[model samples]
Target chain A: MDIFGVPIQALMGQLMLGIVNGSFYAVLSLGLAIIFGVLKIVNFAHGAFFMLGAFTAFLLGQHLGANYWVALVAAPIAVALFGMLFEWLFLRRLYGLDPIYGLLLTFSLVLVLEGGFRVAFGSSGQPYATPEALRGTINLGFMVLPIYRGFVILAAVLTCLVTWYVIERTSVGARLRAATERAELTQAFGINVPLLVTLTYGVGVGLAAFAGVLAAPIFHVNPSMGSSLVIIIFAVVVIGGLGSIMGAIVTGLGLGVVEGFTRVFYSEFSSTIVFLVMVLVLLIRPAGLFGREES
Target chain B: MHLRSLTLPLSIVAVLALLAIPFFPQWIYLVFVMKTLCFVLFACAFNLLLGHTGILSFGHAAFFGSGAYIAGHLVKNYGVPFELGILAGGLVAALLGAVIGALAIRRSGIYLAMITLAMSQLVYFFYLQAPFTGAEDGLQRVPRGTFLGVIDLRNDTALYYVVLGIVAVGLWVVWRTVNSPFGQVLRAIREHEPRAISLGYPVARYKILVFTLSAGLSGIAGALKAIIFQLAALYDVHWHTSGDVILMTLLGGMNTVFGPAVGAAIVAALNHYLDPFGAWVTVITGVVFMACVLAFRQGVVGELGRLLKLRRPSRPEQTADQPARGESQP
Candidate 1:
């Protein structure tokens, strides 16, 4: 009934929580991996965009009296458009230069967004209630799972699968891959590579915002929330390897579960275990689990 | 218009300004200058890797914060002399840097930065949970401790001079490292790692050495900060501090010797003046970051050098042939 002196029920509960956390990690890092692949710049503002999504949802609910479903549908689209504007205006200029500048530019956006949110709202977190329909818990025989948490997992998985399918299967996806491999050559083939790049950034940021909406009800919606999570997601990106979409999802979920197990055994180290995994992965397989070794 | 011609005059002016600080109108200004000096050293150490070596380690605060913790514990609890405490902090940070750099140097560019950031997060978690760090409260009321056997650092004037002296020595080390043949090898590695390897240089080894040295020097700065404030708090090790150092380096002209120090002063002054504005400081700082990256990529000192038609002090040929080469808005 117990695994290592902890009860099965408790273990199952933690596992459920871990999967929920993993879902967010998957969605967020998937966005990161996609952005890196096409744009060739790590979007440091990805986390801030995630926070913006949550805030957008909150603001809509407050001012527009929008429901959960409505906010979810609208927030990402709005944030994505903003992201596209950012890409077209600023990020476009940094291409062909050192990638560090891209990172630096996006990082500044983080400061602005987080600071702006903090000033407009207080530094403390704002609470978002779970939707009316998904307020109750379901019994999984072994453990009781919150309906909202289950919904979150389902929604996140669906989003990831759809994104993966679009990027890896469709003809549009072919153009994307071609552009990523050889931008100039792809353009020579008569594609609007610049537009495609801008769209990719928008989609990537939109994905982050989508994850943010999902997280708003579960975690406190606050300015500093994404800053901390972004670092862990960076660990996830590293462990999974950069630019690998499948790798980002799998590693994120696996690390979440691993972190959950660590909590059961060594609760103090739950926050640090992912980083430890990163260090180990770097030692054994420097290219990352899913990444190709750079020339 | 040669930068070398201005170096002597600039150095003399800077020294005079530093010495005159103690005689400033207000006593509170000393605290500001001391803090700025600490950041100046921290930013310079950071530049050794970023500006000179072309390696971006985003998690640099791990070494800095650990150094503070180590030095603070030694001085406050173990009764070690301040000198030994500071050295111990630097050595420990160097060890940490070696371990991190050895793993991180395996990957180049963006990946390297992520690895360092992740490792520093791990370090941050440790400090957050560790008993010795006093959790969030930090190691407070740490004794200033006497310098040597008798200098009496308890006096604010005495402590300021000691801080200034140590920071000067630290800056000299950075200068020596950059001007030495070893520094040339670092530049070669930075410009092109593959070429450096083809030329039979141990590229990874050199990267690790610079990383270790940078971390050690940063540790000295952090240790000195702990002594000056008489406390070792969590923010010193936070990623925000790491980001601040990067900003200072970039805004001051990473390639120039004294650019980061000037950048540090500007940032410190901003923080001091903007203390009344609450969250606006973060917004302003962010604006500054954007402005620097977008328009002023060459930084304050680098821009000055360009305006005067003075060749870049470190490498005149690179500047003349390709102005703002990597940083140009292409």
Candidate 2:
């Protein structure tokens, strides 16, 4: 299984790492795309929400004695509820203003949430042990793989597929898309557009939280954990073309692998490489890979 | 006419009074205040691009951090005078801004922001790996040296005066730039790009030029800061610095001349006061941002300016609705 003098074992190891990272990237970007498409806001607080989700899981586990599965499901829901509250209380007012206001507001929200978390939990990374059920590794013929990594990859893919199916194929998805495209007309059809908007925001933020829960065992939960990843996700969203779910999912996964490979070859440039790709993508296709042309 | 003639002298007096801060018992507090003032210049410079030019930059810290690094290196290794070190930092940042801005301005909106962010991250990595920057340890123990070869900037009084002088000059330049015909064109572009383009303005070139100027000014602030603090660390170049500047500008009022300064002062003071709260600083910053955007959109200074009716006279009213005023298309 060796190629180019690199061991198959090492290659498989990096590949597994790439896939796991890709899972998080895919899920997070999917949420971003959904929110952007419907709300027309970049939702800069998305990363903060993700951080909160992980922390929620940690808190619930520690205090409520909640098991991993329960925390996994409940954390995102809790985050979604918070997201709904935010939309209702703050974001709904800014829909008429420039998109910059939305970006600014969400940016502020990120600061507050991240700051609050840091103050409460301290600045250091908190460790979350992997659940017993998903512990250990599986020995494939060519290479060994972590069971948790495989689970993350599988779960992330399932989430993406379900989201895509719901948004693209179902009647509810049709209503959602219509509401975004023409809120007034959707209202004329007797559908509650405001509720739909709130629900969409919740669902989008919830996805970010879900990814956070999945990421807890792999990445240490920390106050500043989300800050580093948020910028990269922004690049991903831009390259994929904001508001395009498929584009977000595809670009997120693909860029994660590209980043992983860059780490293998040029360790120093790994962080900047994604941004470089974004620049190149913008140069070649201003509207993004899957973004519709702005009228 | 009386008010017009008194403006410069009044501002000078104000500047001198600010310079007198170190005479007080709270000299240590003056250092902290001066540092915040430096960030005000950074944020205001950034707002020239983001607020007036309507181009959100995600990589502005490249200029700022690079300037700090260059200044730190010059003071530490080359033994250059403090003024020269700051000047060299500004020049380096200007050069970088010209190159990066040229490439980035080819795209619009989100693409532009992403490209700048990437370019800055690239520079951040470069600084991290570059030998002179000291990588992880950063450049430290930088000498403050003498100001203009006479006054010792190492002394708190001298440093406070130097910082005040720099802040006054930077603010004057920003005010002048925003009020000039060139600045009006920029505002036009921000409010309506198509109209500005149709009016025969080279929109992209103007944007890039202003961006370069702003970046260079911000570099001056960052470089001066490194000299004052006697250190240039990796944290200065990180995206968070860029975010901090954005927060400052947004919190203070984006387009107003004094907004970034006021915002910087408040944020810096809060940072110092809230040191006990640790990581919660981010949460507080986020809350402020949310509150500002949700309600205080005009920002602290901008809102104040509006309240006081101190906004610069409207360009349209001054020009008598003529299309051919100044450099207007024939």
Candidate 3:
């Protein structure tokens, strides 16, 4: 049962873990791509929103006695509403300005949000327990997988496909594309471009929150969690090509698997490997793997 | 209508205040000033890429931290002279800058920022895993070697003066670069890359040049801090260090030559006073960030320069290359 000096089971286990992690990466990067594509703004607070989603779930569970099931549905919705509200209140003003302003503004929100949480919860991280129903393990011939992880992978892949379908295949996606490409023209065609932009942003934020909720059981619910992962996600965005949907999904999953394998073989270099890949990608394709060169 | 300019006297007073810092009776406050001065150099280095070249680098701390690590490892382990160690630190950072700058400068705006951040985080991970870095404990009890093998930097006062000298020279170099033709071209490139190219400027070369210089100078700052404190820690190279430098430059003013130093001083002071609040400093810094972006985009010195220009109409775009990095100055 040995495969290249590592056990077959170990290899399979790592691969499964990698896919689960990849699913999270795929979902997160999709949200980033959507925001950057339509809004022309890099939502730096995406990670913060992710953390907030987890925290929102945490808070709901604690205060309102909502279970994990309730949180799984409500957290992303709550975050989406918050995201839409912010888009209306603040991000709306930054539309015509340099995208850097949007970056700075959202960057500040990260600080504020993380700082607030740190003050309230302290930085040590609170854990959410796995629900009793999904607490078992599934054994394949090569490996034994945690049921929760399998579910996560399945959920995440489905979400990614659905998101891609909606954005790339649906009429609403067409409208969304048209609005971003030519807002005034879309407006002339009787489309609510402004409202569409807001909705797109909400959906984007909701995706990040959904990822966050999924992560709550896997990782500790901590203030620094979002900030930490966000940097890696940024790398994923860069490697995949900014605003490229499929690029984001593919690169996220690929890098996550690469990272997971790196963890198994040469564990010490796991984190740095993604960045090295980014550096290599940039050197080879300055426009990114899927990004078109801007005029 | 005929008010005499007070710039000369103001500068002299500021210089005098700086010169008088070590003379202060309280060692704690003087240490604080020492730390502030180091960050001043670091922030100014960062601002060279940011304000002058119009690059929003989120990972300049890699250079700074690398410099510290290199210097600390050399001096603490190999017993290299502090002067040579410092030079070595800057050289290493410069080399790193050349590589990172070359890659990062290829992309513009947000992409460039993210690239720098990723690379720096990579560096952090390297340090975390690298045994020589002394990761958890860092390179501790680094020896304070002599300057030129003559001046003993072991004493706090001697170290302070040396640091001040290094910072003075560093600031002067940045100031010189900012007002130089190269600096102007960088500003031009920052303001508008397409136009700069149309004008036959090798925009990327200029960016890499400034990026390298800034990174080298930032490395020197980190090296100096390691020397003064006799410690080189992981915290020195963290993204927070990069953010701190950015915060300093933003708060002080992005457009002005003296802005980052001024911003660094203010932030360091505030950090000292607000030390009891623990993480509130980050929150406050974020508040300042929002405030500056929203209403006070010009920053403190930018505002001051505007006030000084009260006799003339404000050139809003001239003071900052806002709305985007390296997009349009003309």
Compared with the true structure, what per-residue lDDT tens digits does model 2 show for residues B71-161?
A: 9999889998888899999889988998889878876765577668768877888899898998899899999989889998878777887
Ranking by DockQ: 1, 3, 2
Clash counts for the predictions, in order: 0, 12, 5
| CAPRI quality of model 3 | medium
Q: Tens digit of lDDT per residue, candidate 2, span A16-128?
A: 78778878889999998888878878787888888989999999999999988999999999999999999999899999777777877787787778777766777889999
Q: What TM-score, over all chains together, does every model reach?
A: 0.97, 0.92, 0.95
Candidate 2 Cα errors over 4 Å, as ranges = B1-13, B26-28, B309-330
Q: What Cα-based lDDT does every candidate model obtain? A: 0.89, 0.82, 0.85
The order by descending lDDT is 1, 3, 2
| lDDT over C-alpha atoms for residue A247 of model 3 | 87
Estimate how well candidate 1 is docked, as a DockQ score: 0.85
TM-score for candidate 2:
0.92
- Fraction of true contacts reproduced, model 1? 0.77
Error of 3 at A103 (Å): 1.5
Residue range with the least summed lDDT across 10 consecutive positions in model 3 chain A: A286-295
